[model samples]
Target: MGVVNVTQSQPVASMPEEDRKLSFREKVAATIGNMTGTMHNQIIATFLLFFYTDILEISPAYVAGLFLVARIIDAILVPVFGVFVDKVSTPWGKYVPYFAILGVPIAIFGWLTFTDFGLGANGNVIYVTATYLVYSILISIKYAPSNAVGPAITKRIDDRISMGQIGYIAIMLGALFASLAFQPLYKALGNGNDARGFSLIMGLVGLVGILVSIFQVTSLKERYINPNNSQKTPLKEMISAVFTNRSAVVLYIYVLALNLSNGIRTAIMIHYFKYFFNNEGLVVIYGAVSILPTFLGVMVSGPITRRFGIKINVLAASVVNVICMLSVMVIPDTKAGIIIFMALNAITAFFLGASTPAQGSMMPAAMDYTEWKTGKNVNGLMGSIQGFVQTLAMALAGSIAAWALHVVGYVPGVEQSSETIFGLKLLMGVLPAFVLLFTASILWFDISEEKQKQITKELAERRQQKS
Candidate 1:
């Protein structure tokens, strides 16, 4: 609870002006942009694997192999995208212009990924793989800048937390829409043909994606620009700098574990509902039950972060989430048991949703810490590595889930054996519980709010001296 004393440091010879306050209109636009973007991404992560394996009858092993390869490529390209972002200077500034140029192509390819091209096994493989890779590349191109945009829009930690809350609302909205609507929409729209339904659904998502990019580029303004970003570092130097960031390293590891757990759980959820519950439609029911508590968690996250720093809040939420998940693992799968489990799931989802704002808030603070230590603000590089680690974790989860199902002799759309049922349950409940526990244990983040305050003060002093 110590107050950060910026005035103790030597005063600037002259202070010019304070950062401009973000308007409500801009905030709304930014929030919508994040909402739509996250919604589109959520659909891909949540439904695409099922679509590939179940609807299209593609070999899960083949799809899994492709997922692993694409992630490897993503790992390589993410940092390269980081370096590219750092080096480029445009009239719209470094981050915003990419949204304008790349948005359409990203949307189109994202749509194409879910479409049925009437391609046979070989043709389908090529079409799906090629389109997915291109969409991933475009997402990588935009993710760094899009993430960096939050910190750029505001420097005050409280303001950033408020923005984070808004963003989480967007996250929940996106997730809720995807979770509740995907099955029904596909059923109603596709009229029993899942491929066509998925295509139609994605076409709608694609249009929304384009509109989001337009809104973001047009309505948002970047107010905080790092003075150190003026000179571009070589890729080797950038990589070296990113690794040297201790807090960034910690955040990356934490994010990887978090996303990995979610990825595996998400990839297996439909199967669990279909086989274990004998009610495939229960997925939507669970989503419906989750909406209220999850929204409450997101709404309260900002105040909680303001009161007890983001690190503590995130850690506490993670621990609570683990406990809830453990309860889920032990609960029976009967009617009453399922109701209790869904209630617990709702509570756990709340904490998970609550932690998200803190998660987003941590990175920019880490970037500030990195700049304070290394005298270079590599937001693009930081964003890239964070994105890389997260994408890689999720990709790995999908690959592992696919392979795990294959190992257990899973046959889609058929009655599974007890062994396969146990495996699915393990994936859904037990393994993710362990992963969440591990995540909670390792989240010993050292970057406190007072430290961030000090960093912000020092960076401002440096910028004034430079000017």
Candidate 2:
């Protein structure tokens, strides 16, 4: 799984003469690059299913199958890719080159997924399978390495948190833009031929995202403490390292739960809006309300983390999210009721967004722990597990939504029954709330903020001594 490279051979502790700290501008540029990459992902994850089903007229079953297959492939490939990333020594550095080479293709595939070329059901399925596979692979390439790069860029705990805040703000904005634009863009492009237009717009967005990522690659510098750029570890050793790293395992479970909760929320949104509110346009309203809170939360996360700590913030936010989710169960779906739910949901979004930066920043700490404990750095492998967990959660959420629709006797492309409609309403609101409660419970196991700082300081001290 890993490749050996011809680079300076030294122990992980071999210290360079000087530590290169990134300038604030370089950090900001890096954050923007990371944000663009994540934004590209959010657009596809949030809207791709809806686009395929509603606009492209693909079958729910087929779409589900495609997601399942692609995810399975991704799960296997991600760890291997992680090893590959760890092994390679490039002029651009270990992890940044993937952004340059694969970023554009990733965006191109995103556009292709939204395009409707008048392909019949069978033809469309084939086209989607091929294109989607390419999209998944390219995304894996860019995502796994980019994730690994975050830690490589800086060893400063506070700086990493700050970088994560900037990245989170970017991600929230990207999500907000996609949420705000998808429906209007689809409509403006002409409902009949809008699929093509949507595809084009997404393609352009993807291209712009890639270019932004490239700017990050050129502008940001890696702060390598260990000057020894040695041959990559073997695949067997990498896998062993990943499995043995308890912190990585805990973080993986945490990420999986987070994704599951979020995925359920996303899958149920369309159903909730259409049936409960009796206004399809409420989708935009929902997006606006939810994202606004997230925007505010991301803005304050860095300072909050600095003051209170990541674990406490995450736990507090999870509790708030649970309250908000339960509130949705009590609120009806009428205009006034919807407003109340949206307000509560907005609060939930704020907490979730705020917690996300902390969680993301913690990942590098986990990677460092793995390296310290196991005498190896497997950032790519760790990130691959993260990617697998996230996509797996999305696949499960999609499947759950589809199956729920079928159980409630939801008929696509036709007028729905009252019972079916009622079921849809429940799925959108109550189901996600239940999932949130479960996620909140599991999140209690996370490491405290003080503990994280302790871990970071200890790892750095160890590296300093070894060097």
Candidate 3:
């Protein structure tokens, strides 16, 4: 519904590979890029908070504030960087250089984020926060541009849909890879002292991830960068268009909730399984099993979406996520609890993957709508907000988990009080369920299938005119 004013300047055009379908090899390469991008973050998300609380001995409340403040800073930077991407280019490419060149710094900062050089409690607070912020900046540079790559790869719906599943599959693979390697490497390197082990583990693993990224990214091409977008389409107008597109707004809502819920759950899982379930090792099982279904879901999502359409695909995924999380509200003490919880958790992960392609398609669709309306591409600006949503949710998740720990009287490496145990249940289960359900409700307002067909037709004609 938001109309961008483009009368002031005309957009210069290039050949956009909007309709080109990727080959199997190209898809594999992109999947590698997506996988590598996810692995380092998954490492941080899975273990950094636990390290902060248990190893560094930072206060939970202060840790909460630390994460939240970084998010606030990240929120501001995401937009600035978004506009920067929209307005700038490099010899390497518009979006490619950010990931290709910046990958080294990202790995370095990622290592630094986990390293502790005898920083006292107060010093650790400052040091950890600084490293985290730098890491965030490097990630923002890499991730914002990377987000645009999928849309750039191809504009065909079926490809986007398949790419979505592939993208999510890649993400889960990264997370799974992190989970498998993280526990063993840290424990082995540290000689049972995880705090000391992480610096070594992160540095080594992060380097490998970055290397894979370089190989993967260089193999790919950016066929869709519109060189004149920034010259003609002002930043203000592009930002305005993001809000006016209801589908984009829906994306914002969905991402915020999705990231927040997942973050809270991820940030708390080590604690949840260890203290509440009295089976700390189950955390590894938890990681493996929860992500296992993603592959199956990805395989089936294409057929499912073609049959049901995108709107229903996304809605059903979120709704089932709610149900699965709700079923996890109470963890029983018997062996049956482990079996039951893992089963439900797998289902939750399945939907998460099943809906991924559909979810992935939404942002590109929203971007196309904006371009259709204004004849300008603002993928960079839109991608930044999506990245920001992840950061914002991660920030809130850390803060909330820490705050909840305080409320629950959670003491590290001790038998938790009954209230603490119950609180963990609610934090991991009830909270995320409700958040996801709220996210699903926003689906009703999304752009309908018929509307999308019309938009696609009109945009194709417009592109032909420019060609």
**Highest TM-score scorer:** 1
Question: Which segments of candidate 3 are over 4 A away from where they belong?
Answer: 1-18, 46-69, 111-132, 186-203, 268-276, 329-332, 405-424, 448-454
Candidate number achieving the greatest lDDT relative to the actual structure: 3
Each model's C-alpha lDDT?
Answer: 0.76, 0.71, 0.76
**Cα distance off (Å), candidate 2, residue 258:** 1.6
Error of 3 at 329 (Å): 4.6
**At residue 147, what lDDT does model 2 achieve?**
77
Per-residue lDDT value at 341 in model 3: 88
Clash pairs (backbone) in predicted model 1? none
Q: Candidate 2 residues 1-467, lDDT tens each?
A: 33322233343432442234567777777667555566667767777888789877889898888877787788778777767777666776777667677776777787787777878888988898898899877886565777787777776677777777778877766766666665677666655676766877776777786777678678866664343332456667877877776666767776776677777777777766776667777777777777677878887888888788777787788778766766665677577897787788788888877877887777787776666556677787777678777778877887888788888898765667878766775676567656655444434344455555454455555567665
Residue 105 of model 3, lDDT score? 80
Decide which is better by lDDT, 2 or 3.
3
Candidate 3 structure quality by residue, lDDT tens digits, 344-458: 8898778777788887887877877777777667788888888888777877887788897788788998898888888888888888777776687456555665666556656
Candidates 1 and 3 compared: the better one by TM-score is: 1
Pairs in steric clash, model 3: none
lDDT of 1 by residue, 284-380 (tens): 7877887787778888888787788788888887788767756655667688877887888888878867777777788888877766666665788
